[model samples]
Target: MMVDGVVARLRELDGELAPGDGVAVFNGMYLAVTEEVRDRLAGGRFDDPAAVAELDVLFAGRYLAAVAADQAGRRPAACWRPLFTARRQPGVHPVQFALAGISAHVEHDLPLAVVDTCRSRRCPPQQLSADYHRINDVLADLEARVREQLMPGPDPLEAADPLTHLVGCWSLDRARDAAWASAQALWALHRLPPAYAALATALDESVGAVCRRLLTPLVRRRSGGGQDQGGQDQLECSGLPSA
Candidate 1:
């Protein structure tokens, strides 16, 4: 799909789902990221705008395709399995959900997207490395904003808070670095079909596991009988455990 079409689909999603819904959380962040890339393309931020645009659309398409597959009762990539499975769970925070989506996209889909773009453009992975890193820069900026918007406010034990612990465990910088490595590795395996398949499968599973861990329920204690706005279950409605 074209960039405009992708943006429109995301906007429709943003309007359809609840603001704090797990998928919606990630969708909103992704929408912003895509829009930024679009702006950069128009501003001549990159040496090869066409290549960048192709990579961006292909990257977003992986996400959109996964959503469509999941809705059609087909399983998405292993890396996307976690978000699709836990998106509606009662204990996962919206931020965690968003981070989990980001993890899968960056860690698993990105390397594959790189390969796909190279095939479409008839170029090597190295040719796209600059654009890849440029997209990474955009994602990193959005990551910071997601953290700031979704993270809990300061509290006495905030440093020791479970949510804080969860966020600290996952690093976008590390994911981006790993993606670059994977892209290079895939580039090398391009001529070895069997080896390429093996590595791709391994990458998908490993990234999926990371996403699953990121989405783990981090319930702060509560006294109530139900989940809160962000789908977090709480018994006391605060940090203290249930009486």
Candidate 2:
């Protein structure tokens, strides 16, 4: 239901924003992932397509809710705070925006979605682990594609490159590992009054902080306000000051 609706919302966003817009870049990547999942569900890729659909809807709801909150001038969850605020900033790269959104969604929102799905389906967390892992695999594949398509390059491994440092620091693999742990913890604490909420809040705040750091602007230097790198022309920021 809601998962079906999310695809429409993402398409609306894609049409409204420019290609280079930070939010638009990330939304496009996310839209790809969501559509892939939608196809997988329709093709019966999972043991319980209905349950997987529920989880996907709940997971996407968190992101949609944050966008709504930001539009309304209200505070969104901590994990979403960075992407929402930095998405339109001039110096922030589209790759950074995409990764930051992924960080927030996977690290903070996903585990909670898993728990919620389990509760809704009257099942244990373990029962949903297969679907969870399958979804993660999808994300992992998409991340590689995103980097190939969106990353500005001078070879990310080049020494003394700021982008290299940023790339090294942000990893979806690590985030997914933490999310799985959080899901287990949340399931374990499900019946404990207040504790579950507190843990979830802590997870949200911690992931948000990571996203904030990831969105931190790196110095962009190029001539004539743009440059060709890795066979693609990119608009880059400028300026330098001596120490």
Candidate 3:
């Protein structure tokens, strides 16, 4: 199994991707595997390293195939979707079990992290605890590295905060576009808009700050003029968040 630091870092990086983006899809799979390990650890189902490796391969294969399908513009194959879907049945393929196990694990972990973070009055809604942040940073760095490897773009590490890069791509207008959808879903799932409202407020405030900070730097970096590069260097040397 991957170490906790590695797993946390992966989550941080993957979280930057728009939901359903290919990188996010792969991250989701790995998250599921980590969740399974957490669950077994909790329930006393500890397995040997060989068994863990087998599980990893199974989940990775399913995740990769799903990403490929998504890139090809097809609905995810049934195998790639969450296991609790009505189509799934008992005694399914071993891969199905692995997927199901991992899904449950991730589901549990998210709420736990959110709740823990929320409980810490000092913690920001959008950021995890320091250790968690470190783990997340590692994950974000890894994802950026992978993207650089495959896409060969400018230095993601230097250009902007990956989380901000992600949020900038998802502007307030985009979030507001789905406001109705989000309200309806939250109402149906949680039977409460008050909590959702609070989260929405926090998200709006955070996104607004992110937008202003990211805009000028983003424009400068993309403009690719020598002048912009100089400005960017000045901004960096000033040691202030972009604005």
Candidate 4:
């Protein structure tokens, strides 16, 4: 239930930050939390439940503080503020988008890790073990379904939905490799405490950008070969950079 605890804490924070100011805040918080967890795990500190709890508290507190500042019309106070603000708006709430992205990442790893750890425990609770196994099974099935939907076909337009295609591509096991590679690039650019700041920032920005590109109509038009004068005018109107 280690990952369950993490997910629970994230949900609690999400609830606290309801009516989110925008995706930037949520991205910042999610990156902060996950990077904390990842670092702790990498450092072997997550073996102790108490340590994990402490980490959760620290992350939750920091995220809440940032959210409060955001709500007050003050800039977020952190190294990643510029990256977060790149896509955020003054009034748009990003809570749901952030939660979804974070949840997807968690779903991709945490539950499976919890199940494995529980199975290896000397005196694991049977009920908890069973619950984790079920969760893992369900996730596997869902991933398989998503893969089936994403398999390339003769008609390229059949996979025109970029959001679905992106999700499917990243659902593969190799997505972790991509994420790690990207994190490494970020690390090279901006070193931070515990060597995790860059990794977290990278994940937050990459995920946020992907979501915006996939879900925003402005992005879709640019990708759909709409390069006529009207399309150019629309692009200028939207203030998006040229493709």
Backbone atom clashes (below 3 Å) for every candidate? 7, 0, 3, 2
Error of 4 at 102 (Å): 2.9
Better of 1 and 3 by TM-score: 1
As for lDDT, the candidate ahead, 3 or 4, is: 4
The digit string of per-residue lDDT tens for model 1 on 33-143 reads 999998999998897899888888888888999889988999998888888887777767778888999999999888888898898989998998777788888999999
Distance from true location, Cα of 126 in model 1, Å: 1.2
Query: Over the stretch 129-172, how does candidate 3's per-residue lDDT look in tens digits?
Result: 22333333333443443334433144455554442343235322
Worst 10 residues of 3 by lDDT: 234-243
Worst 10 residues of 1 by lDDT: 234-243
Runs with alpha carbons beyond 4 Å of true place in candidate 3: 1-25, 28-112, 116-128, 152-195, 198-243
Rate residue 171 of model 2 by lDDT. 86
Question: What lDDT does candidate 4 reach at residue 148?
Answer: 49
Angstrom error at residue 231, model 2: 22
**Which tens-of-lDDT digit does each residue in 35-87 have in candidate 4?**
44545445664335543344334434444454567668786443223323533
Q: What is the lDDT of residue 62 in candidate 1?
A: 88
List pairs with backbone clashes in candidate 3: 9-139, 10-139, 13-140
Which of candidates 2 and 4 reaches a greater lDDT?
A: 2
The residue ranges of model 4 lying beyond 4 angstroms of the native Cα positions read 1-46, 77-96, 99-160, 168-243
